[model samples]
Target: MKTIDQTQQEIVEEFSMFSDWMDKYEYIIDMGKNLEQLPDDFKKDEFLIPGCQSRVWLVPEFRDDKVFFKTDSDAIITKGIACLIVRIFNGRTKEEISKSKLFFIEKIGLVQNLSPTRANGLASMVDKIYRYVK
Candidate 1:
C-alpha cells in the first residue's frame, strides 16, 4: 500500500492537473473504489465513528513507526470519504500524522458542500485518528 505522504503528493499533483472541483471529486471517488472492504465484525459499535451521517469504522494499527488503517462505511459516499482518509494517513508515523495538513473537508473539496453534520463527522474522524496516534 502507498504511504500517506505518497498519496498526498499524488493528490496534490492530481489536483494541480485538474482545474475544477468536479475533477477532484471524481478522483476522490476513484480512489475510494480501491479501498478494501471492511469485515462485518469490524463495523460494530465499538468501532463506530461519531458525528457521521453514515456508519463508519476505522481500525488503526501501529507497527514499525507507521500507522495502518482499515476503514469501512455504510454509505457509499462516506465510504469514499473514509478511503480518502486512509489513503492520506495510513502507513504514516505519529509525527508524520501530527504534522499532516490533511484538511479533511477542504482537500476532499467538501468545505461548502457537505451538510453541517457531515462536516462535523469529518472533523470527528480526523480527531479519532489523532487520538489514536497519541
Candidate 2:
C-alpha cells in the first residue's frame, strides 16, 4: 500500500496540473463526486463536525489495526476536501495516520485559498480524524 506521504504527493502533483483556481475547484468538486456515499445512519449529531459551515459527517472504523474513514458534507467543496483527507488517511494504521503532517494541503495552496471558515473546518476534520486514532 502507498504511504500517506506518497498519496499526498500524488495529490499535490495532480493539483499542480491546474493553472487556475477555477480548474482546481472543478477538480475538487469532481473528487467529491467520486467519494463513497455515506449512509444515512452515520449522519448523526455525534458524527457531525462542529466548525464547518456545512454539515459534515465522519465515521471511522478500526480493523486489524488499520483505520478506514467514511465522510460526507452538504457542501461540495467541503466534501471534496474531506475526500482528499480520506484518501490520505483511510486504510492506514493508526500510528501512520497519527504521525502524518499533511503537507499536501499547503503544497496545493488549499489552506491559503480557503476562506477562514473553510480553513477552520478543514482543521476540524483533521482533528476529528486524530481523535479517532487515540
Candidate 3:
C-alpha cells in the first residue's frame, strides 16, 4: 500500500498531464464516476459535512490502528474531489493522517482553479477528514 504522501504525489503527476483546467475537470469528473457508492444507510444527516454547497457524507472507520474513510457527495464535481481525498488518506494510520497536508490541491492549482464555493466545500471536506482521523 502507498503512503499518503506517495498517493498525493501520484495524483499531482496525474493532474500535471492535463494541459488545461477543463481537461483537469474532466479528469476529476471521471474520477468521481469511479467512486464507490456510499450506502443509503451511511448518508444520514449525522454524517453530513457542513459548509458545502452540495450534500456530502463522510464516515471514518478505525481498525488495527489504520483509518479508512467512506464518503459520497450529491454533486458530480464534489464527488470527484472527495474521491481524490479518500484515495490519498484511506488506509492510513492516525499518526500518518494527523499532520498530513493535502499539498496536491495547491500543487495542482485546485484551490485557485475552483470556484470559491467549491473551494470552501473542499476545505470543509478535508477538515472533516482531519477531525475524524483525530
Candidate 4:
C-alpha cells in the first residue's frame, strides 16, 4: 500500500491538472458521486459531525489492524471533500492516520477556496476522524 504522503502527493498532482477552481469543483463533485454509500444504519445522529453547514456522518471500523471509514454528506461539495479524506485515511493503520499531516488539503488550495462555514465543517471532519483514531 502507498504511504500516506505518497497518496497525498498523488492527489496534489491530480489537482494540479485542473485549469481552474471551477474545474476542480466539478472534479470534486464527480468524486463525491463515485463515493460508496454509507449504510442507513450508520447515519444516526451519533455519527453526525457537528459544525457543518451540511449534515455529515462518519462511521469507522477497525479490521486487521487498519481503520476503514465510511462517510456521507448532504452537500455535494462536502461529500466530495469527504471522499478525498476517506480515500487517504481509510484502511490505514492508526499510527499512519495519527501521524498524517494531510497537507493535500492546503496543497490543493481546497481550504482557501472554501466558504468559511465549509472550512469549519472540514475542520470538524478532521476532528471527528482523529477522535475515532483515539
The TM-scores of all predictions, comma-separated, are 0.78, 0.92, 0.91, 0.92
Badly placed stretches (over 4 Å) of model 1 are: 1-6, 104-108, 113-120
Off by over 4 Å in 4: 113-119
User: How many residue pairs clash per model?
Assistant: 0, 0, 0, 0
Task: Quantify how close model 4 is to the true structure by its C-alpha RMSD in Å.
Answer: 1.8
The segments of candidate 3 whose C-alpha lies over 4 angstroms from its true place after superposition are: 113-119
lDDT string, candidate 4, 23-93, tens digits: 99999999989888888999999989888878889888899999988899878888998888889997899
What are the per-residue Cα lDDT tens digits for candidate 1 across 11-35?
6676677678787777767766767
Q: On a 0 to 1 TM-score scale, where does candidate 1 land against the true structure? A: 0.78
What is the C-alpha local distance difference test score of each model?
0.74, 0.85, 0.84, 0.85
What digit string (tens of lDDT, one per residue) describes model 3 on residues 1-134?
A: 88888999999999999989999999999988888899999999888988787888988888889888898998888889888888998888888998887788888877752344654477777877788767
How far out, in Å, is residue 105 in model 3?
A: 0.6
Error of 2 at 71 (Å): 0.6
Residue-by-residue lDDT tens digits, candidate 2, 26-130? 999998888878889999999998877788898888889898888999888889988899889989998898788878988888775234465357778788898
Q: Output the better candidate (1/3) by lDDT.
A: 3
Those runs of model 2 whose alpha carbons end farther than 4 Å from true positions after fitting are: 113-120
